[model samples]
Target: MKTLKIFSLAAVSVLLSTVIIAQSKTETFKVSGNCGMCKTKIEKAAKEAGAKEASWNAESKELTVTYKSSSTNAAKIQEKNSSSRV
Candidate 1:
């Protein structure tokens, strides 16, 4: 019985940790841009919109962002990037 209780507690702890870790999310999508300046602007806007990490590829025109889901989401980041002058 004691061993079973410990196992249950351990399982719960692991589940809680997984839930916490899942709050951080990563997303990638295409973003139109032409130059290094556009990359800078797009990345900056994503960060301003609560992205923890932002990378824009000039050749691929793709932006990959990592952020806390509790603080922000992919749509918000995309909206901010779209409104920016890039």
Candidate 2:
């Protein structure tokens, strides 16, 4: 019973750590653009900047991105957009 409790606690700790890590590493920000073409360009730029997932909304002009913090950050993604002239 004690061993089972220890195992369950360990599992919960790992799960919580994963959630925290994922949330802390991901970020959302705005990228300037105007249409479907803009969405395509922005998302492509984000991906090129090392994001694991890049989604842009034309209506809101918001980009939601997920990336490894060790590899990339929000600034890098936005910089890609600005540099690409997209």
Candidate 3:
């Protein structure tokens, strides 16, 4: 009975961790910019806003940012880029 209880507790812990991970997601946004220097500034701000990764496609004006949803979101990420030294 003790071993069964331990196993059940372990399973519950695993399930909770999985739920937490599933709730965290990456989001993207479109940001306007002109040059390479502007791109650097915008990307930097995204990192400061908790984005684990950030990339800008100048041709499309789309910024692809990967951040944990628990830490950041699409609207907030755009705000960061908009306030950069561009």
C-alpha lDDT of all candidate models, in order: 0.93, 0.86, 0.81
Best by lDDT: 1
> Best-fitting candidate, measured by TM-score?
1
Q: What is the RMSD, in Å, between candidate 1 and the native fold over all Cα?
A: 3.5
Model 3 segments beyond 4 Å from truth? 1-14, 21-24
Clashing pairs in 1: none
Report lDDT (Cα) of residue 57, candidate 2.
85
Q: Tens digit of lDDT per residue, candidate 3, span 1-86? A: 99999999999999998788657566666788878987888888888988889998788878888877777887787877677554
Clash pairs of candidate 3? Answer: none
Least lDDT summed over 10 consecutive residues: which range in candidate 1? 77-86
Error of 3 at 53 (Å): 0.1
| Residue-by-residue lDDT tens digits, candidate 2, 31-84 | 888888888888999999999999998878889998987678899899999999
Candidate 2 versus the native: TM-score? 0.70
